[model samples]
Target: MALFFFLTAQSQNKDLPDVGIIPKIVVKAIGVNTDIQGIIKNDSNLFKTLSSELIIISNMGAKNASKAEQKDNFSIAPDEVKIVATKNINVADTDNIIVLFLIYEDEKLIARDRKELRRQKNDPNVSDGLEIKGLVVENVRSKVGKDFYDYFYQQFTLKNPESDQLVKVEEQLGIGIGTRIQIKVQEDLVFESFARPNEEQLVNLANSAVARVLQYFKQKERQKQLLRQF
Candidate 1:
């Protein structure tokens, strides 16, 4: 099983900005009406701003399996939030969900977020419990391994403390085979090193791993921007 941790601010990737689907469900005497909007956020401190070419695709669905979608373009400055796509649907009930997608340059998918629209009848205190996760560590053992884990944690935390970046330090062990360490960011392996190296070597490996992780994310950011230019 994969472990879960949460770095708030954006999607599972720190490379792209955040696009959230905010749905307000109103219960009428006859049926229900849902108003959903896409809230795009850009953290200039961590990422670049999204210009007018950014497209937000909003999808609204109900328990009856009916789906509706809206698309629009938007621009948001760094350290700013703007509402993009607005979709109002007459849903059958409060059992609904909104999925907002950010398509960069119409070809690449940069980011997306989802929210459930629900209401409990006659229960005003019902809460829609949502769980979010960030930064995961896997199968770390022994003092050597612990040292590596600690170092990677400190370095990554300092680099991206407020990003929803999923980080994993996976350890592979078996009989007669060399152990393996793979540090991954957003499901992409950034560094795979240090089977059974010495303590000093392990520290160095951690340093490389952290640097590779950051470099990988930085490269992703640049790649998306290049896609936008052409």
Candidate 2:
């Protein structure tokens, strides 16, 4: 039986993913209100399921500025800019996290037609006459969460020691000996607003924010892979 088990273990080891020590990661969710809070709380179960998962940072908030700044003749910084408000949530099972973020900066709010143009024509520079730039809100919960999960999953299956007999023996022994995992995160509110003739700018900015989060994950994955080779 021992010999039979040894042979089986050697064969199984060959098929196991070459994953080494599970890489540590920093999980961070960026956005205002529902987008950030809802996703983290919703995936609380998944976090618990992953044995080595560490939520280094979560529920970061930012404040939006409500004033405008004039730069070069062609460009204007939105009056209201979003800035990070606070640190990550510490307690577990906290729900409905409310995080305020800057959605816009200083820029002139304009109307589509001339109906209101006459009123502003006489007082183009009037502060009261100027329109308020709409508030920009975004949710970034799912993007951050999924990125962390996928990266962890890939690392787990890729660098760990492979041994069929060892796996079976470990199962029979009922001992837990596997890869170690860690996580860390840094959250920041980035500006993605435009004072233009269309709404496409805001959409593009939000997309950019999500892409940044994905890029962060990919970079970390590469680091982990390099570490495993040593």
Candidate 3:
């Protein structure tokens, strides 16, 4: 009977729908704030890398959806893509921008996305309260990750797109992978009261956020796989 049950379980597993249908996605372009030189360059690079990773996952999901459509003998439209920018935080009185991509179909929303980088501060003594600033910044980054994930999930559901595979692709891609890239202040623009803040701290914070996002994505994907198995 034990062997019989084991064989039954194996059969059940084989009967389960495969979650491997999701295709890889590629990210081409991400939008950023153009006002600050330091912020813009760093953010652009960050988004570019992020976009490429997401594209791989999205393509996976899209492939799954396309297959489903083909099986049903229906047409699937191309994903609607757009990049959105918003001011989510302020540093030294300068607003920090959050850039994200949106994938949707017609009036329906599909996926909401973002890659964030902090804006450079011009204020003298900005680094004086580094401890306090760090704490606040950390919290902000956490919130950003949570918000981003929630938005993506919500949009994904709304679109009702074919595949649930790429939901957790963020984890596999290492969303926040490196040190916070900082803008160099020109020597001629130096302020006597200023102390240069360490960019490494920001980079660490960014990496932590990226790690969280990746984990979140992986978790979601696992959940979807479980659902399909049943």
Candidate 4:
């Protein structure tokens, strides 16, 4: 059997500069399980410290950075995601920026990544910018050449058009292979299917997830274009 769910929020940024009614953006960090605990293992202090780091990096030195904490609305579920924090900042006169994240385990640096930030400078754009943080997963149960275990669950987060909000999407499957299913799409989309049966299947799932995000934007653009034409 398989199951899936999603959540969304309507948030706004209050720190953007008023520049003669220039467009405003709701920057969001997107990925799978990018919470504080997801990056590190078994460390609370480190999680808090990294949480601060994420907020700072997302701000990109803008005067009005978000003071929200990282653990806000975050939970320990199979794959539940939320808008952990929100920042009201200016994006005027800046082409783009780069944010760096460092992941460590047991006081040792294990992984690192550089995130690129570029404003969406086109009409019909849902938000000004989208930040692709990365993906993190845990609790994998496997055995040598055997698929005889039990208890399987997975979760992920989806970014909505509104600022300071995230769509927590999750799925659960156990004991058998099943067909993929696309549940629904509104401000947020939820997709549930059987667990990946192989590496190729996993890649397909990842690609489908990315396509869903792109499709959301495309739908937004379609709405905007129709309104303009009318």
12-107 per-residue lDDT for model 3 (tens digits)? 123333321112111111122121110111112112221111211111223332111100011222331222222222123222223333323233
lDDT of 2 at 202: 33
Order the candidate numbers by lDDT, best to worst: 1, 4, 3, 2
Provide the TM-score for each candidate, comma-separated: 0.39, 0.20, 0.20, 0.31
Model 4: which ten-residue window has the lowest total lDDT?
Answer: 144-153
List residue ranges in candidate 2 displaced over 4 A: 1-198
Expressed as tens digits, the lDDT of each residue in 1-230 for candidate 1 is 11111112334345664443221111111134434445554544544333222222222343356555555655555543445555555544334344444445344556654444433344333212211223445567655567677666544543443334678888876445446788887687788865554765766787788788777777877898999999
Better of 1 and 2 by TM-score: 1
| Full-model lDDT, candidate 3 | 0.25
The residue ranges of model 1 lying beyond 4 angstroms of the native Cα positions read: 1-134, 161-163, 174-178
**Residue 62 local lDDT, model 2:** 26
Off by over 4 Å in 4: 1-166, 178-192
- Tell me how many clashing residue pairs each candidate has: 4, 35, 20, 1
Select the stronger candidate by TM-score from 3 and 4: 4
Clashing pairs in 4: 79-155
Stretches of candidate 3 exceeding 4 Å from the true structure: 1-197
Candidate 1: residue pairs that collide: 5-133, 5-134, 6-133, 6-134
| Decoy 3 TM-score against native | 0.20
Top-lDDT structure, candidate number: 1
Predicted candidate 2 versus true structure: per-residue lDDT over 70-174, tens digit per residue = 112121122211111223432222221222221111332210100001112234333322121111222223333333333332222222222111000000111
